[model samples]
Target: MIGTSISRWSMTYFAMALAWLLAALVMMVAGIGYPAADLATPNTLVLVHVVCIGWLSLAMCGALFQFVPVLVAKPLFSEKWELPALALLSAGLVLLLAGFLSLGGRLPPALWLLPLGAVMLVGGFGLVVVDLGLTAWLRPAGPARFVLVGLASLCATAAFGAVFAFALAGCAGSAGEVILAEGIPLHAVAGLGGWLTLTAMGVSYRLLAMFMLSPDVDDQQSRWTLAAGAFAVAVTVAGGALAVGFASGLNVVLSISAILGLASAVLYGRDISGMFRLRKRRHLELNMRMATLSFASLAGTGLLGIALVSIDAFTEQIGAFAFLAIFGWLSGLVLAKLYKIVAFLTWLETYGPVMGRAPTPRVQDLVAEGRATKWFVIYYAAVWIGTVTLLIAEPNTFRIAAVAMIVGVVGIAREIVRIRRLADVAGPQRLPIGTVMPHLLYANP
Candidate 1:
C-alpha cells in the first residue's frame, strides 16, 4: 500500500490556486498592476497577495499534505484538519482581496477586513504547521528538517504580514509607520526568500532526484545549501527586526543578509546541477526541462538582487526583481512541477487499487506531453519578454507580453482540466470512484 492516503484536499487546493493564477493573469493583462502602474499601489498589492497567498501558498500546503506523508513513510498526523485549513485560507484570502479592492477606492468601511482576513489566514496556516510539524517530528528525515524550518519561516511570515496589515489599517500608530517603512523589506524577504524559496528548494531536492532517477543526494552540498539558506533567513529576520526597533545600522544588516542570501542561491544552484549530472535517466521530461528555466531564473534573480542592493538601485529595480522572482522563478517552477505531480497523483489515486487486477495505463499516459510542452514554452517565453520589457521601462511591450502569458496560462489550465477528466475517455469503469463528479470537487477521488 502507499504509505498514506492521498490528501483529500490536495486537488481542491490546486484547483483554487490555478483559478487565482488565471485571475491574476487576467488582471495583469488588463494593466491593473505592476509594469503598468506603481508597484506599491493598492491594485499591485491585491495582485501580489492574490498570487502569493491564494496561488503559491495554497499549492505548497496542498503538496505538503500529500508529499510529507510520502517523504516520512507515515500517514499525516490528522487528515481531518486539512479541509478546515483550506476553508479558512480561502475565506481569508477572499476577504483580504476585498480589503485591497476597498483600499483602491471600493468600499471604504471594508478596510477593517484586512486585519480580520490576516488573522484567519494565520490561523489556517497555523493548523497546517501543527499537522506537518508533528508529522516531520515523527519521521525526522533530513528533508523534513528543511520543511520544519520552512514552516517556522511561514509562521513568521504570516505574523509579520498580519502586523503589516494592521499597519495598513492605521491601528499601530507610530510603530506602524516605522514598520511600514523599514519592515516591509524584511517581510518580503522572509516570505519570498525564506518561506517560499527554502520550502521549494527542500521539496525539489527530493522530487528532482526521484523523478530523474538519480542517486540519493543528501550530500555535503545539499546540507550547506540548507544551512546557508537558514542562516541567511535568520540574519535577515533578526537584523531587520533590530534595525527597525532600534533605528540604527539598517543598511549594514540588510547588506550582510543579502550577501548571505546570494551565497545560498549559488550553493543551491550548484547542488541541483550536480543532481542532474548524476541522474541515470538520459531523457529529461518536459517538467524537468521547464524546471531548468526556473532554476536559471533563480540564479539570474539572485544576481540582479545582489547587484541592485550593492549599488543602492534597489528601489528602482525592486519591481522588476519581484516580477522575475515570483512569476519567472517561483510560479514557473510550481506550474512545471504540477504538470507531473498532478498526473502522478491522479494516476495513483485512480489506478493504484486496480493495478494488479486489471491492465492500466502508466502515469505518463495520463498527460500528453507533446501538446503540453507548447504551453510551457509560450509561458516562459512571455515571462522572459515581460521581465525584460518591465526592466527597460517599456509598459506597452510588457502589456503585450502579459497578454501572451495570459494565453499560456489559459492553455495550461485547459490541459490540467483535460487530465482530470481522463476517466471519461479511459471509460467510467476505469475510475476508482463510482460517480463522474469533478475530481477536484470531492474529498475522495
Candidate 2:
C-alpha cells in the first residue's frame, strides 16, 4: 500500500518535505557562524513542525486514503475531502511555520496564526482519524487494528503538541509547566515511540509480506508481537506518567517498564526479520530496503539506550538519543519509502489500467533510480554526520549537515513534481481494455 497511491502520497510528502527543507535552510543561513541554541530555535521549531506534521503526517494521510480502500474492498468514504484536506494542511503548515519564525524574533502577535493554523491542521487529522477509524472498525481484521492503534497514538501526539503550541503562545501557566515537566515528554514518547513507530511496524507487517510475495502472516506470533508491542507502549507510557505525577518509587517503576518494553522490541525484531528470512522473493524492493534500515535503527536505538544507561551517560547525551530516534531512524525510513512510493504512485495513476494484459510498465519505469540514489545517500550521510556534530557541539559542522539535508530536500521535490505531471495525464493508456476509446487520448499513449 505504500506504493499504491504513490502519486498522491508522493506529491503530499514531497511538498511537505520541501517546506521543511526550506525552513531548515533558512535556519542554516540565519544561524551561520552563530552559536547553535540549546533547544531548537524558533526557525528550527517551525521546521520541526513542517517535517513532522506537514511532511510525515500528510504522507501518512495520503497513503491511507488509497491503502484503506484496498484493505476493506471499498472506495474512500469521500473523495471530495481529499483536495480540501490537502489545501488546508498545506496552508496550516505555512501559517504555523510563519508563527514559529515570528515567535523566534520579537514574539509578535501575528504568532497567533500558528495556533489558529494548528487547529485547522489538527482538524484535518481529525477528519482522517474519524474516517479511517470507522473503516478500521468495519473490517476489524488484518493490519487495520494496528493502524487504529497508530491513529490513537497520533491523536495523543496532537493533543500533546497542542500543549506545546500553547506554550509557544505564552498562554501556558502552571498547567502548561506541569505538562512540559511531565505531560510533554510523555506526549513525545507516545508520539514518536508509540504513534509513529507502532504505525511503521504495523504497516511493515503487511507490506513486507506483499513485497516479498509471501502468504499473509496472520498467525499467533504475528498477533502476539503486535499485541505485546501495543501493550508495552501503553503500560510504559502510563507508568511513566504515574511515576512523574505521584513522585513515588518512580525509578523502579520506570525500570521495570523499560524491561517490558525491551522484551517487546525483541519479539517484534524476531518476527520482522523472520519475514525477511522466509521471503518468497529472492531480492528486496526499494521499500523493503528502507524498511529493513528502519527496523535496524529501531533496534539499535534500544541497544544504545541500554549502553547509555549502563555507563551513566544518559543525561549527558540525551539530545543525541533523540536525534538518532527521530532523524536518524525515522527520517531515514520515511525518505527511503518516499522515493519508491512516488514512483509507484506515478505508475499506478498513469499506467495501472494497462498493467495485467499488455506489456505493462514495471514499477521501476516511473523514475530513474540512479538520479535519486545520491540524495538518499547524502541524506543518510548527513543524519550520521549531524548526530556526531550534535554530540560534539560544533556549529559549523551542524550547518554543513543542515545544508546537506536541504540539498536532499530539493532533490526529493523535483522527483515529486515529475511524478505529479505523469499522474495528471488522462488518456487511452489510462482507459480500461476493449473500449472504443477517444482518439484524442490515444496520441498521448
Candidate 3:
C-alpha cells in the first residue's frame, strides 16, 4: 500500500517536470539573454523559476508526500488531502507562470496570482511538514529527524520567497528590489543547500542502504552534515547580503561562512562516497547512474568555484558558477533522480499486484537509457559550454546556450513520453489514476 502511494506521487512529480521542461524549451527557442532578467526584461529568471519551482520543488513535494510516511512507518495523516494538495500546487505553478510571462518586464496584474498560488502551495507543504513531524514522534527514526530539519529549511526558504512575492505584488514597501536582491540568495541557499540537499542526503542514506544492500552508518554523520549545512547557508547568505549592501565587516563574515559552506559540501561528498564504496550492487541502474553523474557535477562545480574565487573572477561574472551549480549540478541530480524514480513508481503501482502472477518488467524496461543518454549528455555538455561562453562572451552566449537547452528539452521530453506509455499496458497493470501524466517536466537539469 505504501509503495503504491509513493508510486503515484512519483508519477505526479515526473509529469509536472515534463511540463516545466517543455515550457523552458519554448522559452529558450524564443530566445532571451541569460543571467535571467525579470523586471528588466523576461530573461532566464523565468526559466530558473520553471526549473526550480515548477520542476524541482513540485517534484520534491510529491516525492516527499509519499516517502515521508514510509520513513516514519506511519500512514499519511490526511490521505484525503493528498490529491487536493497536488492540485493546488499544480494550479498555483501554472498561475504563477502565467502571471510571470504575461507580466513580461513590468509587474502585471497576474503577478499577484503568483503569491496566492504560492500561498496554497506553502499551506500544503506546512500540512505535510506537520504530519511528518507527528510521525517522527511516534517512529523515532533517524530519517524522520533529518526530514523534519529539511522541512524547517524549506519553510525558511519559502518565507524568504514569500517576502519577494509580496514585494513584487506591490503589497510591500519600496524596498522590493532590496528585498529581492538580499533575500533571494538566502532563499536559494536554504532551498538548494539547506532544504533540497539536506533532504536528498537524508533520503539517500536510507535508499542507498536499502538498494545497495549496505549496513547503515551512524546517524551522527548525517545529523552533523545537516547542522553544518543549515548553519553555513544561513550565515553565508546573510553575510552575502551585507557584503552586497556594502556594509562594513561583511566581507570577512561572508568569507568565513563561505568556507563553512565549502566544508559542509566536503563532508557531504565524503559521506556519499562511503555509501557508494560500500554499495553491494555491482551494476548500478539508471537512477544510480544519474546520481553518480550529479555527484560528479557537484564536485566539478565546487572546483569551479575555487578557481573563480582564487582569480577574483566572481566580481566580473557572478553567475559563472551559479549557472553550473544550479542548472548543472543541483538540477542535474534532480533530473537523474526523477528518471529512476518515475520508472520505479510506474513499475510498482502498475505492476506490483501482478508480481509473480504475471511477467513483470523490471524498472529498467520502462525507458531505454541508450536512447536517453544522448540527451542527458547533450544537456550537460551544452550547459558546460554555455557556462564558459557566458563567462567569456557575456550577452551573446545565451543565444547558443539557449539552442543547447532546446535540444535538451526535446531529448528529455522524448524520454518522458516513453515512460508514460508504460502505464498504457492493459490488464491489472493499468494505473488507477489515468494515462495522462503532467506535461511539465523541463528545466536545464
Candidate 4:
C-alpha cells in the first residue's frame, strides 16, 4: 500500500516547516523584518534564511522523502536518518539566525556560531542528498534526473552559503570580500532558480499529469525544457564564479546568462501550457487552479530579471525580483500543492489501511474546500498587491498587504490541521458498490 511506502517522519518536518513560514510572515507583517528593512540588513538576512532554509528547504525535503519513491518506483534508501537530519537542520537554523541577529555588536561568541551552524546545516542536507541520490540512481527515470541535478544544486547553494556565513563573521580575508560581492547574487540564483524551482518543475511534471489524468509527458518538448533549464543554471553559476575569482567582464557573462535563463523560462511556460491542454480533468481542483498563479509569477520574474539586466538596473530591481520569485512564485506554489498534498497524505495515513475492511471518506472529503478556497484567493491577491507596492517603494502599503497575507496563511494552516483530525468530524461513512473517490474521479481519462 502507498502508506507503507511513505516515510514516518515527513509530516513532523512538514508541520514544523509550516510553523516557520507563518512565523516569518508574521515578522514581516509586524515590521520586524523583510519589507520594512533594507535588503542587505541583518533583519532582511534573517527573514531570508528563515523562509529559505527553515521553511522551504525543510518542506521540500519532507516532500522528497515521501514522494521520491512514488516518482522512481522505489523505496527511500534510509528512513532512519530522517530524525537526526531534522534535529541538525533545526538546531543549525537557530544558531544561524542568532548569529545574524548579533552581527551589529562585537560578540565573538555569537559570530563563532555562524560557521558552526553552517557545518550542521550542510551536514544535515548532505545526509538527505546522499539517501535520495542513491534511491534515484537505483531506478533512473526522466523526472529522477531533474531531481538528482536539483540535489547537486542544493549542495552547491549550501556550500556557497557556508562561505557567506564565514565571510559575514569576518573570518574570510580579502577573498571573502570578492565572494561577498559576486557570490551573494549567485547564491540566490542557485538556491531559488536551480535548487527550488528546478526541483518543483521536475516534481510537478509527474504529479500534475497523474492528478489531472493526463498522458505521460515524455515528449521532445519536455526534454528540451529540461536541457535548456540545466544549461541556463550551469552558465549562470560558472559565470558568477568566474566573476568572483577574476574580476573582469562581469557584465557580458551576466547578460548572456540572463538571456539564456529567459529562454529556459519560455520553454517551461510552453511545457506547462501543454500539460493543461492535455489534461482530462475538465474541472481543475482548487490546488491546480491556484498553481496557475505560481506559473505566471515564474514567467513574470524571468522577464523582469532580463529587463533589469538589460537596463543596468540590477541593483535597483533585485529586491523586488527576489520578492516576486520567493514569495509570489515559490511560496505560492508550495501552499497550493500543500492544500492537496496534506489531505492526500493524511488519508493515506489514517484511512488507506482500512479501505476494503470498512467504509472510508475519500481524500477530498477530508478537506473543507468551500472554506479553503477563499484563503488561497486572499493569499495570492495579497502577494500581488505587496509585490506591486514594494516595487513602487511604498512601505505602508506593503505592510498592510503583508498583514492580509498572514491572515490568509493562518486560515490555510487551520484547514490543514482540521484535515489531519478528520475522524473527529466525519467518523466513518459507508459507500455503495461502484462508488468513485473524489481524488480519483477522473482516473480513467
Candidate 5:
C-alpha cells in the first residue's frame, strides 16, 4: 500500500489546505457566512467557494498527487509543476474572494479580479489535469479509471465556474448571462457530486482496501458504482447545459440524474460494506473506524438529496444539505485519511532507508490514535449541531457549533503537525540526533 514513491509537493498542498480550512472556519465563526448572512448572497458564496475550492479541492489534489501514481503504477508525468500549480491556485483564490467581497459592496470596484482569478484558477487546475490525465492514460486500470472520470468532471466544473465569473465581471454576453442565471446548480453538481465524490469513491476504494488489508475491489460492484456515478454526472452536466441554453425539459432530466446518482451512492456504499466484510486486517484502525461514520454521512446525503430534488426543494434546502455533504461526508473522509496518510508517508521517509540496519518504528507506532479519537468525536458532533441549527434557522447556535468544530479542526491539525515532527516516536524507536529529516528536495536513492 505504501509501496509507491511519496509526492514531493503534497505536504505543501496539505499545509495550504489546512490553512484555508481554518480560515474558512474562522470566517464562519465570525459570522461572515451562512447563519450570519443569506445563503444566496455574496457573503455566503465566499464561504462556499473557500471550502469547496480552497479546502476540499486542495486536499483532494494533494491525495491524488500521491496516490494516483500508486493507482496506475506509474510515475507522475511532471512533478515539477505541482508547486507552480499551487502558487497559481492560491493567488487566484485570494483574488477571487476579493472579487466576491467587491461584488457584495464590501470593497471598492474590482470586477477585474473576478475574471483574472478565474483565468488563473483554470490555468492552475488545467496543468494538474494534463499531468495526471497523461499518467492515468499510460496505465489506466482499477481506481485510476475512476480518477480519470473525476478529472473530466473537474474540467466541466471549472468551465461552469469560469462562465459564472465572467458573467459576474460583465465580461461575457448572453451566454455568460445564462450561466449566471441558471448554472450554479450545474457547477455544484459537477464539483461536489462529480469531481469530489467520484474522485473520493475511486481513491477510497483503493485506500480502504490497502489500509484494511482487504482484497482489491476492482470487481463488478466497483465497476457498476463507477459507471452509474460517472453517467449521473454526465447527465447532470448535459441537462444543465440544456437548461442554460433552452431552459426547458430540465425537471425530467434532473430527475433522471438524481435517480442515477442515488443508485451510484447505494452501490458505492455496498462496495464499502463488502470491503469491511472481507478485510484481512481483522482489527480496524482509528481512521477506518471513523470512516464508517463518514460513510453514514454519505448515505444520509444521498437520501436527503433525492427527497430535496424530488420535492423541488433542493435550492431552498441547499444550505443544510451542502453542510452535511461538505463537512460531514467529504471533509470527514479527507481528515480520517489524512490521519493515516501523513503517518504512512512519514514512516516511509524516516524509516525506509534504515529498515534493515535499524529497528525502525512501524507506521502504526508513529500514530497516537487514542489522542485523536476525542477530536474526531468533537468534530462530527459539531457538524451535526451546525446542520441542525441551519435547518431550524438558528444562526447564533450555528456559529457556536462552528466554534466547536474549529477547535476540533485545530486539534486534528495539531496532531498532524506532531506526527510530521516525529513527536510520538519515543524510547528505542527514537532517531539519533544527527539523522537527516526528509526534505522536499530529498530524492530517494
Candidate 6:
C-alpha cells in the first residue's frame, strides 16, 4: 500500500517550478543575469529571484506539502488550500520580476510592485507555513522536527524579504536605505540557509533512508545536526533584526551563527556518510548516486565560504559562492531526487489501487536511469564549469557552459515528462523498455 495519500497539486507545482528553471536557464544562456551583468544590478536581481523564489522555493514547498504529511503521519490541514497558495506564489513572483524590471528601465516605473508583490508572497508563504507547521507540530518526530525549524526559517525569510521590498520601494526613507545596505545578507541567510538548505537536509534524511532501504539516521545525531542548523538560522535572523533596528551587535551574532552553522554542516556530513556506509542496498540507485555529487558540492560551498570569509574577500567572491550554492548544491539535489520522486508518486497513484489483483510495474519500471544518468553528469559538470568560469571572470566560457546546462536540463525534462505520460510502459514485457527485461523485446541497460 502507498501509506500516505498522494498530493494532487504537487505535480502541478513541480511543472511550474521546472518551467521557471528552464526560463532562468534560458536567461543565463542569453546573458541576462549575474555573471553576465553586475551582481547588484536590476537584471541580476530579476534572475536571482527567478531562480530563488520561482524555482527553488516553489519546488521545496511543493515537496513539503507532499512529504510533511508522510513524516508526521497526518493529513494536511487542508490539501485543497495548496493550489491557492501556489497561485498566490506564482502571481507574486510575476509582480516581483516586474518590479525588478521597472528598476532596470525595461518597465515604466512600477515601484509599488515591490511591496505589492512581496505582500502576495508573504501571504502565499504564510498559508503554507500554517498548514505544514500545524501538521509537523502535531507530531514532532524524526524529520518532522527538522521540517518545523525549516518552516520557521521560511517565515523569517519572507519577513526579511518583505522588509527589503518596502525599503527598496522608498517607503521607509532612511530606514529603507539602512535595511537595503545591512539586511541583504540576513535575507539571504534566512532564505538559503534556513528555508532551503535546512529543509532539504530534513527531507533528505528520511528520503535517503527510505530509498536505500537503510535504517533511519541515528535519532541522536539527527537531533544534534538539525538543532545546530536551527540555532544558526535563529541567530542569523536575530542578527538581522538588531542590525535593522538598533544597528549594533549584528557582527557578533552573525559570528556565533556562523560557528553554529559550520558545526551543523560537519555533523550532518558525518550522519549522511554513516547512512551510506550502513545501507543494506549494496548497489546505490542513480538518484542516490547523484545526491552524493550534490553533497560534495555542499561541502565545497562550505569550504569556499570559509576561505572567503577568513580572508575578508567574501563580498568580492559572493557571486561565485551563490552560483555554487544555487546551481550545484540546491538545483542538483532537487533534480536528482525529482527523477525518483515523480516516478514513485506516479507508480503509487497509477498502480496502488489495483496492486494485487492486476499486474503492475515496479516504480523502477517507470524510469530509465541509464539514459537519465548522463544528463545528470552533464548538468553537474556544466555547473562546475560555470562556477569556475564565474570565479575566474570568464563570462564567455560561463555562457557556453550555460548552453551545455540547458541541453542537460532539456534532456532531463523530457525524461520526466515521458514518465508522467506513461509513454514507454506497456504490454506483457511488464516493465518499460529502459527497465529490466524478462521478455526478448526489452532494451538492454
TM-score of 2: 0.83
Better lDDT candidate (2, 6): 6
Candidate topping TM-score:
5
* RMSD (CA, Å), each prediction: 2.2, 4.9, 5.0, 4.6, 1.9, 4.7
lDDT of 1 at 355: 69
Ranking by lDDT: 5, 6, 1, 4, 3, 2
Clash pairs, candidate 6, are none
For each predicted model, how many residue pairs clash, with residues at least 3 apart or on different chains?
A: 0, 2, 17, 0, 0, 0
lDDT of 3 by residue, 310-332 (tens): 99886566666777776777677
Task: State the weakest 10-residue window (summed lDDT) of model 6.
Answer: 436-445
Regions of candidate 4 where Cα sits further than 4 Å from its true position: 1-4, 106-109, 306-312, 423-427, 430-445
Question: What C-alpha lDDT do the candidate models reach, one value each?
Answer: 0.83, 0.65, 0.67, 0.80, 0.87, 0.86
lDDT of 6 at 215: 90
**Which numbered prediction scores highest in lDDT against the true structure?**
5
Better of 5 and 6 by TM-score: 5
Model 1, 298-341: lDDT tens digits are 98898787787789888897888888999889999999998788
Q: For model 4, how does the per-residue alpha-carbon lDDT over 265-314 read when each residue is reduced to its tens digit?
A: 78878878888999999899888988999998887887777777788876
Q: List the residue pairs that clash in candidate 1.
A: none
Positional deviation of 436 in candidate 3, in angstroms? 15
Model 5 per-residue lDDT tens digits across residues 1-445: 4456778888878888888999999999899978688877888989999999899999999889989988888899999888889988999888899999999999998989999999999999998899889988898787888899999999999999898889999999987897788777788888998999999999999999889999887577788998998988888898778865886746666778878888989988888898899999999999999888899888888877778778988878879998999999999999999889888888887777677777887888878999999999899889988888987788899989999999999999989888887888888676753344655322233
Candidate 2 lDDT tens digits, 253-282: 556656766776787788877887888898
State every prediction's TM-score relative to the real structure: 0.94, 0.83, 0.83, 0.92, 0.96, 0.94
